[model samples]
Target: MYCYPPHPVRGHPCDNISGNYGTWQANAIQREVVVVGGGAAGLSAARTLIRNGVKNIALLEAQDYLGGRVKTHRQDGILTEDGAEWIHGGSANRLYGLARRMGVLSPRVPDSSYAWSAKTETGRNADPAGYDAAETLYEICERNSVLSQYSDFGYGKCYADKFSGEYRRNRGRRSERAAWLHFLEMWVNKDTGLDDWRDQSARDADHFTDWGLDQWDQWRAGYDALVAHLKKDIPAGTISMSSPVCKIFWDQGDKGQVLVVTQSGVSYLADHALITASVGHLKERQDSLFEPALPRAYRDALAVTELGLADKVQLGWRSSWWGEPHYNLNIIFTNDIQGEKSWLKGIMEFLTIHNQSNMLQAFVPGEYARKMEALPEETVKRHLLSFLADVTGKSIPEPSFFRRTQWQKNVWMRGSYNSYVTVEGGNTIMRSRQPLAQAVEKNGKPVLLWAGEHTHTTRYGTVDGAMDTGEREAYKIIDYMDATFG
Candidate 1:
């Protein structure tokens, strides 16, 4: 089970404890709280607030739908996820726990086969012995806490300089070396959502806590079920869909209420406001989103943190092409000289969707993912079919249906997820995850608080992290209300 560290509630110096605390009034109409963005964090925050007797709250979602990065699509009676597909951890994961309760949790089969490709020809099978040696090296790194020891280097640097040497010595074959390196590259890219592992902070990557499970688990019924579960307790009329917040007006005067204005000129005033926008969106609009502007510290944090793109292409065929697969095919394109700079580089892996015989989903990450999102639908489909045929060494048929996720182009979510980047001679990770609690009033009242996956140090870039931040901010607000308004 995953354990959360205790987050201390910050002292609100702006709250007037002595005289007429609860009766203090401002010019604008008052609300208990206003939550911006209706993703996992926002929904969780709203739920937490309502459960704790904070009813006078407003939740705003820019999109018509509730789930942010956890979108699910159904085509031709087949359910496939457009966003997050797996629960990274075991029972300790909050989303996993929710899935179990909802009876949507399913054990993801640990079945994968890799194929190697050279400049001239593609191999039918990958070097199993070489792959095992690479796995052994990875195990050694994990067991000895190699990344923690080498905090100065990035994941790519550490692997290339240290671990790669060990693997090369064990394997010794040039073909095997290329295959292993390509596999590692694909693995790290998919895991971190970064274009290259060199961009990933080794220390930050090692800091994540997991359930010690090797295999991944999925929500069979789709992530929308989990979103619906979260929304179950939230009161109706509290959530306002399609209400994009334009600007947040705060820090007006002593005891002044925070004003949240929508794009359509509708405004709501609240004692406190929680900004649950994605780090990508925050990075793009932080300067203009706030009326008084954000603090330098917050801006610096945003600058240091990294948001990456990850996209999925789901193809549904009329019939299953690969006859009763003994094991799942995980195609890794190694040296495709013909299509090095195209969508082929971004094609990390293709897997047959669990329980869906005729469906295949391609995992695309990094800069290539953004590029894939820009290409024409037919262009992507044609390239994917040609690439798959080359890797499998068989003629592949066209899919009846095709769907791709455009997270990079999504206005609400400029990128798929967040990852920490190394900043020289400073605590960049902590700064990046630090809650935005700048005192908006003389009495130490924080009118603005930030929550999202990016705001979590250990669990950033996951649904669990988003939910945790939401609950954490909600508790902080609850504590502040109890202390000040009680």
Candidate 2:
């Protein structure tokens, strides 16, 4: 049987820095920069700072481990992931180069062939042609732009508005535009857990460039190896986990020294601090108390930025039932056959990895991801098994082991990484997410900086995005320091 970690309670289980109350006494350490979150973004920022000879730095992570979203688990002789499973893209991913350099990347993944099966509306095996349709839809999306598809947020303006007369006429004949739009929505739903892509601003989708599309790799060692590699260079004590930063006392009344206070009362004073916490973590208005409060722009942005949800469910069977030890399997459009009426069915995409030994996983996104997080173990297992049997038309026995992650409820993450359309007052708020790029000066001194995947307009919601953002933040700080102190 695969042993899992003790279930965590909301806000407390992995609170590493919470117990060290003595560290909160307003340490008089003169640090140049303090990086928070210790995830890929923060760790990358800290590493860059160290490489640049900025020794007066500190990192804070809320979890016990360094890798934030990249986590690997081993169960029932099957390697699994509680967080990130695949590297997402191949050579196009910036992390790809870094991973290869660090020897944590695999150039060729094992033969993981996916067999997609969808159900008809009647709970019967849908036409085998459904996969072909899905394949055609994927090709169309790749050929056309997502931004141009649903130009008007759900019927505001028809697709005709964005096309020429001839093209518009052709699209209008069979309402192909609307049909194509539905396929696009399905694509987004399965890929990133974003539902109703029409609601997302076209501009947000406009700037998207998928670097992971070229080649993809899955790490058997868990995506966390990237985090491990990041920490290997930094001194062990530089990063502190289990510390929930409660209040940040920055630019005390404009000229006062900046102080960061954790829930346990540890305070770290620094000349400047990079707040790299997730956008969701900052949602609970009362959770992070900012002394003197954040700027109006930041407050506005925080209120409008939407945090999307993504969750993973891994099941380990006692014996290899699929009869293949190394093949990646995926079942798409299973809902069409199961006749299921649940929100999760909309975003269910299963990908199998982990030594392929009867271990399978379902990548649930959006509302379904949220629901799965709240389900009982047995209930979740039964539902998954039943669905699998229907798709394969075979009675697949129950999985001996079960593990599911409720990332939406995870205090550290709150929600999965998603690039949302800037909502009402979102533009002003997005500026606050930027790192030193939007540095504010107080009495001829800049006291605050920001950096995280959310802050990057171009590279948001991927490992490469986080890495590039971290690197950018480091350069911004370095440039500012050089110009000011030099």
Each candidate: what lDDT? 0.70, 0.60
Q: Highest TM-score, which number?
A: 1
Against the true structure, what is every candidate's RMSD?
Answer: 7.9, 7.0
Q: What would the per-residue lDDT of candidate 1 be over residues 225-325, giving only the tens digit for each residue?
A: 87898899998889989878766777655675687776655677788899898877777766556768666666656666667777888777788776653
Residue 445 shift from truth in candidate 1, angstroms: 1.2
TM-score of each: 0.87, 0.81
lDDT computed for candidate 1: 0.70
**Pairs with backbone N, CA or C atoms under 3 Å apart (clashes), candidate 1:** 13-443, 13-444, 14-443, 14-444, 14-445, 15-443
Worst ten in a row by lDDT for model 1 = 12-21
Among all candidates shown, the one with the greatest lDDT = 1
Error of 1 at 382 (Å): 0.7
* Candidate 2: Cα lDDT at 23: 55
Stretches of candidate 1 exceeding 4 Å from the true structure: 1-29, 112-124, 137-144, 169-172, 325-327, 332-341, 423-432, 435-442
Residue-level lDDT tens digits of model 2 in 1-486: 212223324455333435342454435455678787887788888998888888788887777777677677765556677765556557767667777777766545443444444443223543333334444444444332543554334311222233333234333323233333333344465455554544445445445566545366766456877877777778777777877676666765454457777665667777777777777675553233565766655555555565666677777777767666554433434223232325346433455554465677766777666667777767777777776676566678877778887778777777775746443322333433343236555766657666666767766777667777777778877887788778
